[model samples]
Target: MNSNYSAQEKNFATALLHNLWKYLLLAASIVATVKIIFFGFDIDE
Candidate 1:
């Protein structure tokens, strides 16, 4: 049915957005770790 398809489409869109956010967070975390390592922050802390 049209309604069922619509709901499935909406769920797929939500999942895509969720994955995008997850990747963004992972990238940010990696950048932060790199920054800290470059600054030698881990040696003291």
Candidate 2:
């Protein structure tokens, strides 16, 4: 029973991490888009 619970917990943690990374990437892209819209796309400067 304890082992089963541990396995479930581990799976939950893995899923949480996966979702966290997904959201982080989404947030980063949104921030980048906002920056480009406000600042213009001046990569050289």
Candidate 3:
């Protein structure tokens, strides 16, 4: 029973990390877009 609970907790932690990464990527993309809009598309660096 303890092992089962531990497995569930691990699953939850993995899922949480996955979701956090998803949101981080989304936020990064949004920031990049905003920067492009503000600075123009001259990202030729």
Best TM-score goes to which candidate? 2
lDDT of 3 by residue, 1-45 (tens): 699999999999999999999999999999999998877756553
Residue-level lDDT of model 2, residues 1-45, one tens digit each, is: 699999999999999999999999999999999998767756645
Pairs with steric clashes in candidate 3: none
Give per-candidate clash totals: 0, 0, 0
Q: Candidate 1, overall lDDT?
A: 0.95
- What TM-score does prediction 2 earn? 0.81
Model 2 off-target regions past 4 Å? Answer: 41-45
Q: How do these models rank on TM-score, best leading?
A: 2, 3, 1
Better of 1 and 2 by lDDT: 1
* Error at 23, model 2, angstroms: 0.6
Give the whole-model CA lDDT for all candidates, comma-separated. 0.95, 0.92, 0.92
* Model 2 lDDT, residue 23, Cα: 100
- Local lDDT at 44 for model 3: 52
Lowest-lDDT window of 10 residues in candidate 1? 36-45
Models 1 onward score TM values of 0.64, 0.81, 0.78
